[model samples]
Target: MVSKVTTVAFQGIEAVPVDVQVHVGPGMVAFNVVGLPDKAVGESRERVRAALSASGLALPAKRVTVNLAPADLPKEGSHYDLPIALGVMAAIGAIPAEFLHGYAVLGELGLDGTLAPVAGVLPAAMGASALGKGLICPAASGSEAAWADRDMDILAPRSLIQLANHFKGTQVLSRPVAKLHGNAGPLPDLAEVKGQETARRALEIAAAGGHNLLMTGPPGSGKSMLASRLPSILPPLTPRELLEVSMIASLAGELAEGKLTDRRPFRAPHHSASMAALVGGGLKARPGEVSLA
Candidate 1:
């Protein structure tokens, strides 16, 4: 019999579904992982083995074959550690296979059986919520997943033993609360400037109209001061805009403590940045500075 666990892969900010299949059956005493996994994923076997051992579970002397489905898609990251471990557990009857049917799991596992936080938990939670499934992630990332949906079912466990205990009804895990950042502390006051009346007026106009501003002047012209104070007069981001900005920041793994903020993002790319850097399309096709700004 095969035990399957659902997880996700990332392409840019999008989360793509991945199936981790584990089978333990009569044959030579061997363990193998298949599918087009990258280096990080290929090495999960050792981590999973050590983690399970730490959790007091031992692999049976049977052929253990794990396959990541959709064989062509490149699987990556140590986040697969949790789901893969869970799949193995389910296959060995250490945990009930039916218990995991409703959830998608992602987390990195420490050799001591602890769950380590990983990037992209927010996006993975969002994907699971969209699919009408619960999410299981590291405890440190619970607050991040909580932002996806207040009603979504989430289980954030600190370790493999803790999660197993929860499933066995020996312990219970609490849902995490979504965290929000307080108001961006005090924007620079526009009144501090003593001169540059023209620049000040232009700044005012741009703030009022939500228009972009480019200040061109020689050194010591108060350009930097004027730009810094612009936020004082600019309106705070609307709720929808705040979420949009937060999503991009989350995808970039920049959201601290999983706290959402109302402050508008301000990005300053280096002058040497190429057009591709500004407009996107590097080897990984990451979001561009222009888009982020």
Candidate 2:
């Protein structure tokens, strides 16, 4: 027979739906990931096996194939890591099918079977919310998932041991709260730059109205250093900005500890970035600096 669960394959900021289908049948010892997985997804077989073994479960000496659909759409990201692992968990009867039925899950697994954070929890939460499903994420990503829903059913399990326990009625998993405070500190008043007084006045005008400024000069003119201090004067990301940044991090699969980055983005792209890299149009259209920033 077969078992199925849902996760996502991200193309830029857009998340394409994917179904993780697991089939367990008697045969030789072979594990395959199908439907156009990239190098990362192909490598998940070893990680999945090692993770389960650490959790004290072994794959039966049977042929197992994981089909990520739709086959025409290429699958990407380590965010598929946990859902693939749990799909096998369900197929092998290690966890109740019902427990997984309502959630769309994703996370990378450690060889020792701990759950490591994966990117894209924010966008995944958005997709899950749209579908009215909850999400299961790595414990480190719990706080990042606070944007899903106030009563968001996002469960952040610190480890497989806890996950298994939660599934078997031996433990409970709590919801993660979204709380990040802002701070204001005294600044070196614009009156401080003695060498470039004209430039300092321009800086004040730019800072006062939240207007963008252009600084054209030769090397060693302090252009770079002046740009670096912009954050010292700007505001923090709003909850919505945090969600967008978190989603970019999620799609890139880089959300850490679910703590939204407090700084607004300021980017200077390299002239060498390829069209695909610049436009989020790789074979999978990964997030370009425009999307990430």
Candidate 3:
């Protein structure tokens, strides 16, 4: 029989759906994973094998083949590990196939069967929610995913055993609460500057009207110091803007502790930055300073 599990593939900050198809049949004792998977994704078989064994499940001796469908989109990252393993479990009847049908799963698995946090959980959660599906992810990322939608279903399991137990009705998993990063302290006051009336006036005008101010001065002219205080005077991001910022940060893997902040993003690249570094696009097509800001 064949079993399928839904997951996602990240393209920039967007999450694209990917279907994992697992088949177990009577034949030679072999296991294989197919699809246009990158090196990290290709190695999931070993991680899945070790993780399942640690979870007290042994692989049946049969011809087992897994295919990440669409077969054209390049699959990357270790997040495919959990879905592939779950697909195998469902195919082998270790876990009920019904439970996985409504959820999209993404996470990495350790040799000990513990789930490891992976990047792009926030975006993945958003995508899953858009599709009207639930999400299964690492516990560490549950709080991050919770921010995607309050009413969205999320399963943040700590290990393969925990997930299996929850599906088996032996244990129940609770939804994670969303978290925010508290401000460290009050920002620097503009009043601290003793002089430079013209510069101060320009800074104030720029802040009020949402304009950029170019400061040209000699050494020790306090250009950097003046720029640092801009955030204090600027307005905070709106809810929609906040989500957009957080999504970019999520894809860049820069969201600290998975906490979203209200402060507006302020990015200042060095003078020597390349064209690609200024705008978004490079070898990996990653977001740059302009896009982040």
Winning model by lDDT: 3
Residue 39 of model 3, lDDT score: 88
Task: Give the runs in model 1 whose Cα sits over 4 Å from its true position.
Answer: 182-184, 272-288
Question: What is candidate 2's lDDT per residue for 41-145, written digit by digit as tens?
Answer: 999999999999998999988999899999998777677778888889889889887788788888888889888887777777888888888988888888877
User: What TM-score would you give candidate 1 relative to the actual structure?
Assistant: 0.89
Residue-level lDDT for 278 in candidate 3: 87
Expressed as tens digits, the lDDT of each residue in 189-211 for candidate 1 is 99988878888899989988989
lDDT of 3 by residue, 162-244 (tens): 99999999999999888888878988778888898888889999999988788999968988788877787888889888888
- Candidate lDDT values, in order: 0.86, 0.79, 0.91
All candidates: CA RMSD in angstroms?
2.4, 3.1, 1.8
Q: State which candidate, 1 or 2, has the greater lDDT.
A: 1
Off by over 4 Å in 2: 179-191, 195-197, 207-210, 250-255, 268-292
* Number of the predicted model whose TM-score against the real structure is largest: 3
Off by over 4 Å in 3: 272-277, 280-283
TM-score of 2: 0.85
Better of 2 and 3 by TM-score: 3
